[model samples]
Target: MAGFRPRVPAPADITMIAHHSVTLLFDLSDGADLAHDARGRYGRGSVAVGLLPGDFRASGRAGEVLQIRLEPVAAAALLGAPADLSGEAVPLEDVWGRDAAQAEDRLRAAGTWGERFTAARDILTRRLTELTRPDTRPPVDQEVAHAWRRTLGSRGRVRVGSLADEVGWSRKRLSARFSSQLGIAPKRAARLVRFDHAAHLLAAGRTAAGVATESGYVDQPHLHRDVKEFTGLTPAAVATAPWLAIDDLAWPASPPPAPMHQRP
Candidate 1:
């Protein structure tokens, strides 16, 4: 989980970028602070932002907000139907109904960030538990799960063909099934992961040339091209993104992801 509380009066750039996970956001302010991006406008309050394939710039007045990132498989289990989210910001009530409002209330009532975090965790856990009690969404495909994990584990360096081989299916079959379940092709997912990794490295103070080499790009220009494609910004600009400066600190356990934004 992460928090955003802009320091200035200027409406924060709040410019959105591509993300690899399904992000759950709780708007702590009056819900009028942030504006939406091209995919769709996120109505204030609780919403889930789906994986964005490319840049999603948005502007908004600065305010407090909390965020949670869920892996695609976990998101499938927890969110259930509409397991096929693309670049949309879906209202939580659409999925959780009135319970979504109640959960957001819990977060809003919390006196501290820790309290809010705990509240969010318990709420999600309860939802996941409820799914197992009766009629529920089918579990994620094991082959697809393995393929995704492999792609992320290898930092997107692995080929989809090898994943197909490991899963005892042809490249074409694996890609089709994966897309059906995850709403994104394996190749695209890998590209996002690789780009995310490179962006995180840049945000962590790595030079474009260094990040390119370390992130598996052929050269700095190649890295620049990908960054531009994903964020509509040069590598240097992405490196200076205010939100990215907090990514490493917020999620230190994993290879840092600039998938979230938190005003410093």
Candidate 2:
């Protein structure tokens, strides 16, 4: 979870890069407009943004907002419909309905960030627990789960074929299962993960050429195309993104690896 309260006015527009994880944004402000390149505009109070939200932007009003990132496996269980949200951003009300409204109210009533964080955690914990009861959807497949971990650990440099082989499943079978459960193909997931790593490198002042080399891209043009496809922005534009500026604060442990020069 991450909290933000802008001291100054919000940017007129802020480009949001695609990410591998599902994002939940709770707007404690009056309201904000979320415009997705594909889905048009949405008025957000509390929203569930799915994987690869494809070059969206948020504008209007600045106030306390909390964002939570959830892995697809966990989000599938919590939202009760991973496939439905694979590449879309839907209102939280669409998933949780009245429960969503109630949770938002509770969060708004909290006096401090700590209180708000606690309230949000309690709400999500209860929902996750209820969804994972014995009779609910089966737990995420063990092999698929491990594959996801390996992909993340390697920063998406792992091959899907190797992952399938390692997990003792045929490539076709692994792809089908992964898509059904995680709302993304394993190969696509790897690409997204790799793109995420490259994006962070760009944000950290690495040249596009350097990022492409270190992030496993074939060349700078490959990285450029991927970034443009995912974010609708050039690497240079993405480097100065307001959204990415707060990533370190929100996700500190996942910092980009040291520059090549810093390596032994």
Candidate 3:
């Protein structure tokens, strides 16, 4: 979870790279708009952005935004739906209905960013609790969950075949189940995770060649191609991306633990 309020207006345009987690953006401004490839205009309010939305740009007046990134396992239960959000961004109202509006109202009513963050967390916690009650939905499979963790822990360098073998499932079965639950093939997820790590390294002043090797890319070109494919930007460009500049402030820690509402 992260809360952001710009002290000044936004820059010209900010290009975002694809990431491995589901993103929830709560708009707390009156005039700013969020636009993406799938949804041209995101009105003022809460918006749910799924994983791996390639190369989207956010352009409009600057404003306060509460951004939450959820792992797919927890996101599935919190969202009251399958984790098939890859390459998609939808209105929060579409997922949470009137509750979405209520949340926004509560956040708006809060006097401080701390208060707003608390309100948003409470709303999400309540929703997750309600959705997971009495078998309303199936939890993500243990094997699938393990695979996702392994991929992320390894910085996307894990071999899917080995993961499947470790989980006692065939490659085909693992791929199918992972895709069905997480909205992305296991192999593709690994690539995205790996690219995310490499992007951060590049941003931190690592040479492209070093980042490629350390991130498990075959070579610099392999890293470059993956960066381009996910972000529509070359490795050099991605190294200086403004979108990544705020990541440390927004998400300072490692991937968070599963929310209490999710099943073990």
- 52: Cα error in model 1, Å: 1.2
How does model 3 score by TM-score? 0.86
Candidate 1: which pairs clash? none
Task: List, residue by residue over 59-99, the lDDT tens digit for candidate 1.
Answer: 56636678788888888788863345676776667766678
Model 2: lowest-lDDT 10 consecutive positions: 255-264
Q: Count of backbone clashes for each model?
A: 0, 0, 0
Error of 2 at 105 (Å): 1.2
lDDT of each: 0.74, 0.75, 0.74
Candidate 3 Cα misplacement greater than 4 A, ranges: 9-13, 30-44, 82-84, 134-137, 250-264
Model 3 Cα lDDT, one tens digit per residue, 1-264: 766655556533445568898888776666435443444544434577788776555555546666788898888778754465677777777776777767777877888766776777788788877777775546778899999999999999899999999999999999999998888899999999999888878877789999999999998999989998888889888776666656563333323321111110
Ranking by TM-score: 3, 2, 1
What shift in Å separates residue 217 of candidate 3 from its native position after superposition? 1.1
TM for every model, in the order presented, reads 0.84, 0.86, 0.86
Question: lDDT (0-100) at residue 208 of candidate 1?
Answer: 92
Looking at candidate 3, what is the lDDT of residue 116?
A: 74
